[model samples]
Target: MKKKELIMIGLMIFSLFFGAGNLIFPPIIGKEAGTNMPITMIFFAVTAIIFPVLGIIAVAKSNGLKNLAGRVDSVFAIVFTVATYLAIGPALAMPRAGTVPFEIAIAPYLPEGSSVKTALFIYTTIFFGVVYWLSLNPNKLLDRISKITSPVFLILIFMLFLGTFIKPMGNYAQPSEIYSKNLGLQGFLDGYLTLDALAALNYGLVVVFVIKSKNIIEEGKITKTVITTGIFAGMMLFIVYMMLAHVGASSASMFPHTKNGAEILANTVRYSYGDFGGILLASIFTIACLNIGVGLTTSLSQYFNLLIKKVPYKIWATIWVIWSYILANMGLNKIMEYSVPVLLAIYPASLVLIMLALLDKWIKGNTIIYKAAVYPTVAVSIISTLDKIGISVPLLTVLAKKLPLHNADLGWISVTVVSFIVSFCIVHFSEENK
Candidate 1:
């Protein structure tokens, strides 16, 4: 592939990773982080960009998540891969991509007395219609998005970022809540909450397939290109995140009571663009969400097609698009409220899997290491996620909260490290005796 092809691949990767839910994260970080915005951004970049880039590289190096995760065993590999797909598919992400933009941009601007549900029904019908059509044509997916959708989306974002400078919001206030306490770790956890890292692991396959379709059949070359593309994509995401966070940080004093990133962004856009700003913001939201819908539906179709050999890609696309449409209409705030804790149930393990996959190149696929890392992290994650939704598991939650970094929601970090060490020692001693 030439430079142009590499650039297109980078753009396509960005488009896939740039979902409405992800976009809504950074600004709130900026708001709460306040004076610590820079520190939060550094940690945010780690969770939001570095981890996801690592995921992409791990998948590329191993050729797929299946192979990367298979070191844990076949049952784990299949189950983990499928769960990752579903979490980012109709279960959470795909639906959010369809609904968040609508809630943030379109619904806010609707005329009074108009039926919101009816309007949503009409909007999603058209939205998923485009998604289904574009997803069905996987070969043209990169071109349609990179050349058309992504550029428009980027331009709109650039305008918003630039506008913030031309007419600034006021200074950031004092840091709030956890951000006031531990900026870096708080931002890191917040970034993890975005779930983009998991998305990147799955997205690598889409980019690899796109490159293969371009006649780059050599595995080494393909993996190298994917890694480079992943870096470029990460850089792009960082830039976008920084810009959004800057907007949020600045608007903090101006809009202190604003609840979340979406509200922060909506306020900034309106302030910058005046009366017509909402329209421009709506355009940005639609383009951003539409790109995700297209990329996700296409990628999910590709994945399910390979997994379930009997089902045609078109049939899978049809099924998912319809399901996502139904979920999307359920209301974005509700979908978001539900998505986080459910994802938390899986995220710690998912991150552990990505870490193990990266280390597997050295560990040489040690199941002991995999088991050590996975088991405690998963147990902690379950207890933590349960606590998050007000479902207390009594002794477990109490014990978990006492673990170091538990207040930051990273008690599992210590668990991951200690378990790996203990497991390594046990395996080494047993093997030496043998």
Candidate 2:
């Protein structure tokens, strides 16, 4: 691909990853982290940017997520792949894409007597309608998102930043209770809420499809291009997070008691630009969510159509859009309440799988090594998620917190590393015995 094409593809990928949760999490961290924002953002970038970029690279190098996870076992490959698509697709992220714009940019401005539920239904119907139409023709996505929509989205965000610079809301206040301790860990955990890493696994193939559409067929060239595009996209995400965090921090005193980043963001723009701020924010979110909705709807339909040949791509697309529409009406907070625990559960396993794929040469495609590394990580992840959601597994939850990084909600890392080591030793020992 040419340099210009590479840049556009990077922008497109960035838009795909920057959806509902992406817009909301950063500012809340900035607001809560206050003086700790700098350190907090660095850790946030690890999961939000670095891991996501690595996921794309890993999937590209391995051809696809299913192929990468299949190295563990066929059953795991099927299960994980399906779970990931759903988690980032119709199950959570897709519904979020539909609802967030309405919540942050539209709902607040709704006429007092208007039914919020009815407004949401009308808005989402139109939202997903545009999404479905654009998704039907994935070939135009690069032009639609990167060339047209994403640039406009960036401009609106810059306007918010300009407003902040022109008239600062308030100074970054003291750290909140949650951000008072383990600020770095808190930031990292917050980044998980974006769910971009899972999107990375799914979006990598979408990028590949775009590249092949341009007739770039060489495997080596495709891998190199995809990795390059991922890096560029990661850099963009980092920059935007920095801007959003600053905006959040500045809004600290003005919107101190806000619940989530959505509230902070809406308040920031409104405070900065008066009545016009609502329009600006609404445009920004609608563009951002629309980009994501199209990318995801297209990608999910493509993947599922390939997986289940009986269901045509259009049917799958319609099914997801309808499902997302139904779930989106349940309201954003409720959707997030149910989705966060599931995201927490699967995110660790996704990270582990990405790391293992990147280290594939060392493991030499050993299924034993794959199982050893992934299974324990997944087990610990499930227990940790259960504990987080207030479900105490008998003996397991207590054992999980004892592991390193549990306080940071990263207890699975140690388990995964230990399992990898034991599996490595067993593989080598058995080979030597033979």
The candidate maximizing lDDT is 2
Candidate 2: lDDT over CA atoms? 0.88
RMSD after Cα superposition, model 1: 2.1
TM-score of each candidate structure, all chains considered together: 0.94, 0.95
Q: For residues 158-233, could you state the per-residue lDDT of candidate 2 as single tens digits?
A: 8988888898788998888778888877888888767788888998788888888889889999989888888899
For residues 1-434, what per-residue lDDT tens digits would candidate 1 score against the true structure? 78888888899988888888777888888888888898889998888888888887778777887877787778978887888888788887778777777778889889999998998888888888988888988899889988998899888888888887889778878888788777877888888877888888788788888999999889899878988888888888888888888888899878888999889889888998887888888888888888888877877888888888899989999999999998878765676687677677777777887788777765667888888888789899889988988899979999998999887678898999999888878877888899
Clashing pairs in 1: none
Per-candidate local distance difference test: 0.83, 0.88
Residue 337 of model 1: what lDDT? 82
